[model samples]
Target: MSANDTAAANTGSDERADFLQALGQHRHFLRFATRDLTDEQAGQRTTASELCLGGLVKHVTSVERGWAGFMAEGPSAMPDFTAMTEADFAKRVDEFKMLPGETLAGVLDAYEKVAAATDELVASLPDLGAAHPLPKAPWFDGDAKWSARRVLMHIIAETAQHAGHADIIRESLDGAKTMG
Candidate 1:
């Protein structure tokens, strides 16, 4: 191809690498917080919040999967948050707990799979600038739209935030700190 085409290709490659690197770093911190924990321990709530180690992993995985789907399929990929019922809210709350029979290993495995898929999607997307209106939610403006890149950034931010939460929970559980 021409020199301009080559430069554009390199730019896309660099952008994808940047996205993946940011995402992977946060994912590492999140997973690192779970080291050597038993399923029971992973499920145990250490702080006043309902969040547990495994539950955080599950929630992050679900968030990444949902955003990635939105990247590919627009607002329809997400449930209407404005229309959620009490049962729907209750089920969402369960995403922050390690339910009975759920293992840390299983939760981590699912997280790994979701992370891999998200990484692949970032690498393969033809255009990160492709935009979609967000699903109806009180937190979102009526006319707000997010590009694929914005969604990826949101995923990274969400992961990093929850990773910090996981670190605190893990430390509370056993004095183990994922970071200083």
Candidate 2:
């Protein structure tokens, strides 16, 4: 309609594009680290840390899904991290290991689905500035709130961090580096 309206629309589109591009790049690096790996190889722990390539992918998918839900549904969408039970902690630990019967392909497919949904949410969210109080957690300030944009950035950071972890695990497993 108006020139101002057009400019605002372009800015939003550009912002979303930038977010998607960063996410895609990190996802590529993470996935590349898993290339040509068998299920057992993907699951093998090559370092002191429990992280494996498939598990890192799975964990990133879960993180993206949870934060995307938080962006859409506020604090209600998040678990009470401050009240997590032993079982909850165990489940979280399982996210870092490829359990039996889990295949690398399956993990990667689920990550693709989660990434697609997050990308769509970034493009369709009405207001990236919309804010919500983070669920009560030891690591978060009690009064702090995060905007959708901030949550997206967190997801990107998480993915990128895990991608590096995956690369290290991969190199340790087979002497193959995702990057120099």
Candidate 3:
């Protein structure tokens, strides 16, 4: 193969590995965000605007759907949250702050289901260079559309941001050190 072909091949491999690694870290943080916390503690919110462990679990599900749901629909992308509104969204997050008598197992089960769906979404799209016609980012204006690669990257960035929230919440719950 020519040098150009070799470079292309290497880039392809790197993209694949990078996607997997990024998604894996998101999933890992999901679990770590709950470590050593009792059910009540995991459900505690640091403030009115914050996410509890359960909320992060649900938001991750929401984001996975948003980023990967309409790979074929492009510009029409944005997940079929057909009737969901910002209030509904906040409600989902609030649900994580369990009521008087909810169990950790219940929360874990919800997260596991969401994670399974997320893994499938990631697996379904192995190539990032693939293009879709989603509206361009605000910075790029509507002139440019996002590619499959950007979609995946968007997910990575989204999850990493929330994972930081999870880490702080987890630490507050159990006094777990910031690092292992």
Best by lDDT, which number?
1
User: Each candidate: what lDDT?
Assistant: 0.93, 0.92, 0.67
Q: What stretches of model 3 exceed 4 Å from their correct place?
A: 1-11, 47-49, 72-103, 135-144, 178-180
**Ten consecutive residues with minimal summed lDDT in candidate 3?**
134-143
What is the C-alpha lDDT profile of model 3 across 1-180, one tens digit per residue?
A: 999879978767556556868877877787677776687776678755566876676667666666666454565666334456798777665654665666667766766776566566656765656776654444445455667778778878877887887777777776674435
Tell me the TM-score of each prediction against the true structure.
Answer: 0.93, 0.93, 0.70
Instruction: Record all residue pairs in model 2 with backbone atoms less than 3 Å apart, i.e. clashing.
Output: none
lDDT for each residue of candidate 2 in 60-171, tens digit (9 for 90 to 100): 9899999999999998999999999999999999998899999999999999998889888888999999999999899999999999999989989998999999889999
Model 1, 1-180: lDDT tens digits are: 999879978777578888899999999999999999999999999999988999999999999999999999999999999999999999989998899889999999999998888888888888999999999999999999999999999999999999999999999999999978
Ranking by TM-score: 1, 2, 3
Q: How many clashes would you count in candidate 3? A: 2
